[model samples]
Target: MVQDVTLVDGAGSGPAAARIPPAPLGRNRDFLLLWSGASMSFLANRVTTVAYPLIVLWHTGSPLAMSVVSTAALLPLLLVQLPAGALVDRWDRRRLMLVCELGRVAAVGSVALALAAGRVTVAHLAAVAFTEASLAVFYRLAERGAVRNIVHPAHLSTALSRNEARGRAAGLLGQPGGVLLQSAGRWVPFGFGVLGYLVSAVSLLLIRKDFQQERDPTAGRGRMAGEIAEGMRWLWRQRFLRAAFAYVAGTNVLFQMLALALILRVKEAGLPSATLAIVLGIGGVGGLCGALVGGWVQRRARQRTLLIAGAVAWAVLIGAMGFTREPVLLGALYAGTGFVGAVFNVAAAVYQVRTTPDALQGRVAAAAGLVGSGTNALGSFAGGLLLAAWGALPTVRAIAIAMAVLALLAAVAPDLKGELPDDGTDTDAVG
Candidate 1:
């Protein structure tokens, strides 16, 4: 007789898989609910991403004011990540997510209502955006930590890849949807976003299973500062993970610079905004395709092979951008870069999920986000400075060369290779 056994939870302890009856992920009702809810949240967030700036620009008619609003929204990432991650690990992830959605509903809905009443101001928009974005930091970290509890271990990679695709699809549609809604009415986009968050909250409420494993009573009892430091220390101790973080950080900077340079190049060539849209659309398609095929790629290739291949592809694609100004060639190169980036993202995400314990997922994610935030800001600064000083082609080539060097370094990290670790031990925490 087949014994009914519970799969090991992401916190690392439960029943052994050898004696358990496996459920196909497709039929896993709880996983489906969580997935659908997350997709809605992502879609709504993307919609607001566009609508926020549009509304600001409409109300103030000043690009400087718009930039200030954007900075206000993003500044929280640097400040909130460390503590947010710690709190997520301490709280009930499902409830945390639900509360976040409700908060978003209030924030976005307030904007809509204010616009309808002709009382919306730039200050109001900035305050709402900052508040909502702050809450989002917690919500996302909580959701990532919670994913492992809802699906089988074998399906985690597939689930994550699907999540990536959902984000890509959201990106592809959300901006256009916001623009169209804005054309109808300024409040329409925010209203649409509010509805999405409400639906998302309903989905969270419908989930029957717990979103976190039972925590050890002593695990999270330390001081908040100590807990945050512990998470960072744990992450740094993993050789491959440290390397992966560096690789991602470097590429993020490179891509940010390259993206800015592309726009400069296009404008210098007198290309229209429509052309820019087409190029971005092509990149989106590439990202979506890569995300969809990520599971297949994971199944077929070793982690080392995937990372190395993706790195090489990025090097080639970015390097090629410097050699041509043809919009079609530039677009194709950009798309290729996006495809490789997606592959790397899936592989890195699987690595992170498999190796880290559920308890520390939030802190680790937050620490990583904190690092990326700094690097991305530096990248934006450097991109504009470099393009202005050296012109587009030369700056593009310099950035590509720097990126290729990083990729080469990543290709040789021994800890990043072979099969996923099977010992089921979080190197930092035995539980």
Candidate 2:
């Protein structure tokens, strides 16, 4: 029931083109509700992400603890994701999302209680946060995978944009909240996170349609791991998608390396948490603009070229983060990097949504998610260690050089420069 759409120019002289059938629910109804709920969930999740680190720092003052939580949160993608994706395809996506939200609600609420009671241990909190994050990744996969079922394909660009917009909005809210909450009580944001999850679950319950297709009585699925491989196989056959996945996974290493370095450098420079918040907020604005512009750019440019440019920009901006200690300069760099990165993300999202087959999207997305996270995990771990070893400036410089080399190569991928096939061959390959 994905909404179908037409992308005619606003000017009448451009000519009218009929799009496919509209989304199952009109723009302002069920879809908006879903959108609002989803956006809030993102905001809440980010709040927890920021709050957790500060809480750990407050309790243990240990960089090692931050590393531990960061590792626990991300490594699940490498280890547990194949089965998670397979499970998503097997379950009712809507119900699964609802249940997943409730699980987060309980987990965060428990953490809040434990923190309030001074009963929280770094180990116990890590377990809660990690489990909650793993579930969150699953719900995100289900949401993206189910979008095609909830709305028509023609409208996919719009739906995806809306989702990105929500995330940006959440980023705006959460970035500041995350920093500010540390000043209040480390436990406060977790309470908000619990509320957000509960509200998101309520929103899921209010959705009106059957988003999942009823399974055929005769069709039997194999093991989750087998299904995961099936998804990966489909991805590999698409030369474009394979390249895209590799590019995304590759760039993430640089992205998080820079981010981790920024935190270390900024904290060392005695910058206020508010300053960091501003940097993140401005970056969120850049992301907002990118999301708005990405669709049009897609219509006009080659995906690989734009994607490569974005990667290069990510590298350069992040390198600049280390070279300058001025808060204003850093904020500007963060904003620019965020804007370009958002363009990259929106473009990639479009490619994935259009190319992947609906039935297999969950698994494909999950596998893709794993690829992205696993790469980021390495970078994050490396970033932490690199900071401990050589200080932030050198690590940032190294990431910059690495990303520049990768972007240079990506721009020349032969398949990226040509016209797409008539039957959406390129789309499927990249998806």
Candidate 3:
């Protein structure tokens, strides 16, 4: 028989806020280790992500092969997230992360070896991509949970902000790093991934703290489906979270479409590809800047205010992009949107982490991610169709209008009016 569980009441929990504060994040040794290792791994993943298609195209000269490998890499985000979340909650998270990193070393290393031996095949590439991505999913989920345990609750927002910035920085550098490395040799990026994963594994080994709170062994081990459901049910009960995630989903879709539209706009205007790259690079810098300030913003702004304001800001910026074609102007406008997005992500992550019980952290994070980003592919496909039918200008204007609608809804939504309570504590129980 399944045992009964009482999930932490996020809204009502207050004791978490009273916990003793830890050292500043800069001086926190474990956080630094976690950050450095994750930063390297994230950068390496970005490098390989860029290289995968380049290598596929260079070798096979087939768009289909490139698409197959790309799809394999993305498939894990859609497939592995939920089960991985469940397992992360059930397993030793640090060990799981170590295993993931080591697994990635082998998976990515195989590709490098194959490429060097001139034995690389589409099937082999697809398999390796899928394996590496799957491991990454697990590692990311575990790391999400692990971060809360290693830091004090008071610094959660600051810690997450730095992490967000690290990710943006990795993306900013990794694309160019991948292209540069690929120019030297197709196998070089994969070799980098192997090295990065090894460093990440070492970092995991050095972390001495437990990744999760003690579990009740007597609470009968539940089925994976039940565990996932428990997390979903908890999440669904929080009106603020539900509204926040819905807003996030809408904005995420709009951003995905906007990115594609930007590329098409550049091409249609007969601008050099370098112009587009520069605009995107500027936007990446904007995101990094926003992440750097996220903790300060979160400390001052109410959650409801931030969400509504960010949406409105996005509406204005995206609308402006629809009317402009000048490269500098376009880059500045896109940068504004990126800035808002990074800040919004940091705030949302802080809220989620501070309120979730340690045991449910992985599952909750996975559910939120799935809800927030599940429609990205659909958005990309719809953007392509819209651009094909109505051109870039019209499609972008339509998205701006949609964003405006989202903003208006957020402003009036009863559930989003007040601040969400955060006790800054982990509320875990077995069912």
Candidate 4:
């Protein structure tokens, strides 16, 4: 009788095939749960985004004050990036997810209470949003590595593609959902926020230890600073990853400019906030379509081809949006941009996870994210000044042109053209 065999494959420990299963199909149950948890969390996040802004604007009626809350939210990326990623490398990711969600529950729960008690101030709102977003970085860094643990090497691309889609969904639905809830009643959104965190926590419970157990080592000791530094250094060596990070960071700047221009244009035209929300909300449909098609694109399109196409599409769609004030027309343009962004984002996440060592996923994600936060901030500030100087439509056109040029340049990265360094690299199957 033929006997069943199993193997521990890492660092040249087994036949590469045994260690690296086929890019995971739907075979990994635990991975599905993890994706679900993160996806729901993303949707909840979008749903709640408007609660704080609406509350602040409603209470204080000052755009500048609300803007401060937005800016303060970026501080945590600077503060926690290094330690967070290092710790994520060490921590039991499942436990970390549970803990982070609970911490958020407590923080937002307190904010909800304070709001109810009439003690919520601009300062209070800023602190809560910053804390929530900060903890998210920690939970996400921990989860990124944990993904490889649950899924086989074969499934990584599809898994990441699905993950990226959730992000687009969050933007598509989350922002508008938040706006909708705030319209119903401010406190209603907070109640919904609390529930979303609870849902995330509950999903974590369903992901069994056997399914979610990480494949990476949690051993290694150093001063916290050194540990963090080590993670960063490892990521820098990967040629493909470095280019992806730069590409993402640059495009984010363009996104901020577009967003700021949209705001100014609406204000100048005396359009209702509802109109902006609805059009942008519908624009999210493009992201959904992009995400749905991402897996097919990954399988058929060369990496470089997908990236170049996505970048070009992003520039064109955003440019089209610049010329439209009609609600339906702008919605279509925004949706198309969302679609292109989904394709670009999903493809990039898959490439990074495939290229980077499992040990470095958290730090790599953190560094890339840090770049995004800082660049987006600078762009937002620039957007405000541009609006004051040349008006909203000009700013939009400028961003569109920049996107086109950046995409053209970034399209030339060697890996995107199929010189992928990790195309056949067999990595540990992380949970």
Candidate 5:
């Protein structure tokens, strides 16, 4: 029941060549509602992410307690992605999203109430973080799968680009906002998070369309493990997608390492927390610009061109991180990295949306996420060890060198460079 419409463009030399430009997404009621809801949800989630440790530390006065709760929040990404993706594919995505929003509200709100009553403990916080994050994994998978269903294929790239911008904006503001709110009261940030969930739920209700294509009833469908296996098999069969997944996973590790190294460098330089925040915050603007330009870039260049360009840009920018300790220079380097990352994300997301069948969207996305995010988590851990063993500058230089090598190899991949099949089927594999 999603609305179907075409865009209008300027007339060509002949009237027959004239085209309708796609309705601006800002005017699309459903998309606006979806975007608003998602924005609130992402902001809320990020706020809670910032507040969780602050709350735990305030209560227990122990960094160990904070780490425990933080670990709990992240554990779900490793454990929940595969199964969550399977459920997202099998369940009514919209309804599942609604359930997730409500559950998040209850989880976060309970902690707020408990804090207000001075009843919260480290154990309480850890349990809540884990449970809420587990639900979030499902919500995210469902939303990603649902977006393609809600918009015309012509507009999908722009729509996803906007989504990426929303996430970046949320990241830009959420941490500072959460810390500011917490200054007023420990419970304030979580209360705002609860409000965000309420808003997201209402937005879901306002949406007037189904978010999935009709699936054939699978009364005797094999176990969920089988469904997950099928999704993985489909993803593996696409050489381009498979390579993309590996590429992203590898880059995620590099970025994670870079992040930790940057933080260490900043700390070593005795930069003020405000300066560090500003440095990090500046990177979000690049991501915003990248997202804004993603559709334009995709339209003008081949996917291979963009991929290689982004890779080259990434290597140069990240390599620069090892050569600077100045906050301003580091900030610029980070911004460049974020910009390239956003471009790659939008390009990759469009490819995934266009090529994957609706039935497999959730599963494939989840499978991809498992690899990318799981490694990111590992990278965080390994980054610390590398920093400890080799020091920040050396660790960063090593990572940068590895990145250049990887980008060079990726640029030469035949499957990446070859023309995609014109029939919209991307199954053609070139070695």
Candidate 6:
């Protein structure tokens, strides 16, 4: 069972008493446990993400080997999302999360042990990376569904904002932490992953709340394909969500192109590689700050407002990038975009969680994730081609033009006109 107690702002009567405020998320024990566990898991994932290529390059001295392992890690995002979402909906989410953490520990631990024995092969590394990533997919889907179950309805937005900030902080710290640990030993980063998963597992054990609503025993017995299709159909029927997904997909592709273009611009200008790092660090800080303020933004603005404004902001910032190659200026522009992205993410996540039924949370989230991120690889490939063909300046200017078009479409889209109610009730009505 989940506890969703409402906390009043102050002792009062009549309407004042009815105006129940949410308890601070910091005071929620179950949510704290969940957050801590997830924080560790996210940090661990980032640490290994940086270490994987480094380990392969150091041990095998083969960029091809590094690419193979990295590709293996990413394959789960493409292949596992749909099916994993289905399983997450059908399975006991808490138990599933426990299994996932244990599986990750074993997979990453195997790599550490192999490295210790001086017997790690590229194939083994690839297999471990794939397995670890696959488990992470399941864990992430389960966690997404579990969030709404653990907090009061009034606190959901704030909870999600904190989660977003945690992820940004992890990204900010994890890569450098990975590199520092690897300097201590090739196996040290993987050992850190093992420890992180163990901590996550322990936290899961301490949580007293259920991660989801009780399911009707007869439901979810359909074939996996059928379940997946049902989820897809539900998402397709939401006019606002459909429009939002399209916007996200387009912006994601454009961002990918911009990232690659930024690197090329720096290289072409004969800047030191550290300049790129400083720019990215600035962007990460900006994202963290945006996430920290996301709750405030969400409470004050409508979903449509955030979406349209974010698209417009991104367009302006990216357009500005086309006019400058200075490291500090590029960093500032990139950071602005990052801020907008984080705020948008928080708003979108709250809308999705508040509207979708608990039974469909995992499937809907997975489906939405696939639609949003499925084109990332295509975007990266296109970015490479565009950079090769037109050089960095022209490619960025072209992307800016495309983004402005996206912003225009967002402003005029009919489905994006009104605000969706966020009363935390599950409904099938189209937004």
Of the candidates shown, which would achieve the greatest lDDT relative to the real structure? 6
Candidate 2 residue-wise lDDT, 253-360, digit = tens:
877887888787778888887777667667778888877776666656667777788778877887787678888788888888877877677767777766666566
Q: Model 3, range 262-297, lDDT digits (tens) per residue?
A: 999999989999999989999999999999999889
Where is the poorest 10-residue window by lDDT in model 2?
Answer: 6-15
Per-candidate RMSD, Å: 3.9, 5.4, 3.9, 5.6, 4.8, 4.0
TM-score of each: 0.93, 0.82, 0.94, 0.84, 0.92, 0.94
Q: Scored by Cα lDDT, where does model 5 land?
A: 0.82
- Please give the distance, in angstroms, between residue 99's alpha carbon in candidate 1 and its true position after superposition: 0.5
* Model 4 Cα shift for residue 349 (angstroms): 0.6
Instruction: Name the runs in model 6 displaced over 4 angstroms.
Output: 1-21, 424-431
Give the alpha carbon lDDT tens digit for every residue of 289-320 in model 5: 88888777776777777776777888788778
Candidate 3's TM-score: 0.94
On the 0 to 100 scale, the lDDT of residue 82 in model 2 is 79
Off by over 4 Å in 3: 1-21, 424-431
Off by over 4 Å in 2: 1-28, 57-67, 116-118, 179-187, 213-220, 261-278, 312-326, 381-398, 415-423, 426-431
Minimum summed lDDT over a 10-residue window in model 5 is located at: 1-10
Ranked by lDDT from best down, the candidates are 6, 3, 5, 1, 2, 4
Candidate 6 has a TM-score of 0.94
**Candidate 3 worst ten-residue window by lDDT:** 1-10
Residue 392, candidate 5: C-alpha displacement in angstroms: 1.7
Output the TM-score of candidate 2: 0.82
Better of 2 and 4 by TM-score: 4
Question: Comparing candidate 1 with candidate 4, which one achieves the higher lDDT?
Answer: 1
Q: Best to worst by TM-score, what's the order?
A: 6, 3, 1, 5, 4, 2
For candidate 1, the per-residue lDDT at 219 reads 75
